[model samples]
Target: MKQHFFVLAALCFAACSKEPVLPANIPTDNPALPANSFTTFNIAKGNHYCDKTAVHVFSDSSMSVKVRFDSSCIYKTIDPGNQDDINKLVGFTEGNNNHLHSARFGWRWSDNALRLFAYSYAAGVRSSKEIATLAIGQEAKLRISLLPTEYVFAVDDTVVTLPRALRSGIANGYWQYPYFGGDEVAPHEIIIEIEEI
Candidate 1:
């Protein structure tokens, strides 16, 4: 009878001590994928935000990440000119509560190819510059360096610089993830594989 009671207590403790489960939509390292370092971000159809919203505090002078886009990134917009509108890639919002004081790498499928851009906002003003064109399914290294007066954005061989609002310090904020659309949500489900290097 004592053995039975002990067994029941053990089982109850085991049941209550299980690890917490993450939501199904959160981005996680999939062993099935060829590279475990890569995290696949999924943006559902008709949604501007990706499934992953994991927050990361960043206070570094530079951030670098490698990203790859699959065929799902290819899409046509209702308005032809909207094709040039840049979508947020990897970045972080500077200061507090205001995305207007931020810098990020941007990408878009335009002119029959995938292109990367240096996108940013300084003191509530917006600016973007085309950095380079990258091939789909190919990993590209992107880096953003926060400087006293500007931001240095580099994608492989190409580099572009944009103005920085804060004159003298490292960035302090949360990491931003993949996002879609300027005037429209994702045309279809989009999958982007990213690994911070």
Candidate 2:
């Protein structure tokens, strides 16, 4: 009888002392980059990291979800060689070779606000555009969908359209994983939550 009571108490303690579980951190070689040493991408709900970061690439299908991130803005000029200093945090993607990727999508902060952008590389040059804007921290439901003809941003039901690209068409390709970035390390952790739709 004493043994049974002790076993029951031990089981109760084990059940009550379970630790909080978090989503797995991305692998060191997260497959998003061709080179190593840029292992700063986290795959949880909210992530706040500074210093020109990128999430793993979602090389599957299009996704529409509710995303949340604080408007912690930092400015840095991107050096083309240091893969660590890229300016883009998220976009649609094509091209599986080298550093030459063509992507068009939105939701990066700049000028004290959030902006939409599209990028493509060709002829030894890269073409990028900051197409539109949104108010930060506004609980916006963002949708980045590639149509048969154009790249579209539907934020809370308002539509903004953009060109596809020369090297990689942003229509129906893989979505580049989300990114958190800046010139220096984040003053504080910057967490962004992406809720599946």
Candidate 3:
């Protein structure tokens, strides 16, 4: 029957031609990007948390950590609306709560000054950003780039990109740094550096 009328007119010209769907470029900001996109953590343990003492000192590379904060408060302030100590219960999470990706930068204790914070958690949901202001030894360089969903928060040159959810997971996890939660410590006598740049 005339080749089924040219196969029903080529299936009605391929269902009237369809095409429109473009999204996925990634790079929310700070795109002078280079240096392998991000992945550097080698701090040879200099762990010490004050208020009851908690120590884990041992990170060999001369990245010294001996901040025995026995209290003499050289400058420690936090109680502005009382975020229960930087709001996060704030720990760089990894694995189930929903799904995860975490990032954390240092030197935080803001009220009047001394802030250079960057915190993130995805899937279970949480976010924080202070970005700059510090002087206890003044030296900052925080970096995090873990993508397979989204998470890129770099500091000192500032870059914050976020979005997470793809099964919501991070099974390649590891992050712990003088983590003091609920019971605080380290009021002075500082010297913590597990830096790798």
How close to the true structure is residue 162 of candidate 3, measured as C-alpha lDDT? Answer: 65
Off by over 4 Å in 3: 1-4, 20-119, 123-129, 133-144, 147-151, 155-197
- Which structure is stronger by TM-score: 1 or 3? 1
lDDT to native, each model: 0.84, 0.47, 0.42
**Model 1: residues with Cα > 4 Å off, grouped in runs:** 1-36
Which pairs, if any, clash in model 3? 44-59, 45-59, 50-185, 50-186, 99-168
* TM-score of each model, in listed order: 0.80, 0.47, 0.24
TM-score of 2: 0.47
Per-residue accuracy of model 1 over 1-197 as CA lDDT, tens digit each? 99999999999988886677877765555322233388888999999998877555667788888899999999998888889889998887787543578889889999899999998989888889999887889999889998898999999878889999887578887678889978889999999998887
Regions of candidate 2 where Cα sits further than 4 Å from its true position: 1-61, 71-89, 97-101, 104-111, 116-136, 165-175, 181-187
Question: Sorted on TM-score, highest at the top, how do the candidates line up?
Answer: 1, 2, 3
Candidate 3 lDDT (Cα, 0 to 1): 0.42
lDDT of 2 by residue, 60-178 (tens): 33445555555443333254333233334455555443135344343454445666555444322455555556555555555655554445656676666554444232333344555
Looking at candidate 3, the ten consecutive residues that score lowest on lDDT are 61-70
Top candidate when judged by TM-score against the true structure: 1
For residues 1-197, write the lDDT of model 3, one tens digit per residue.
99999999999998996675434553223221123333222222222342222222221111211111111213343433432354121123354231244555544455655554556667657666666664564555565555676656665577766665443334344333534322344343433333334
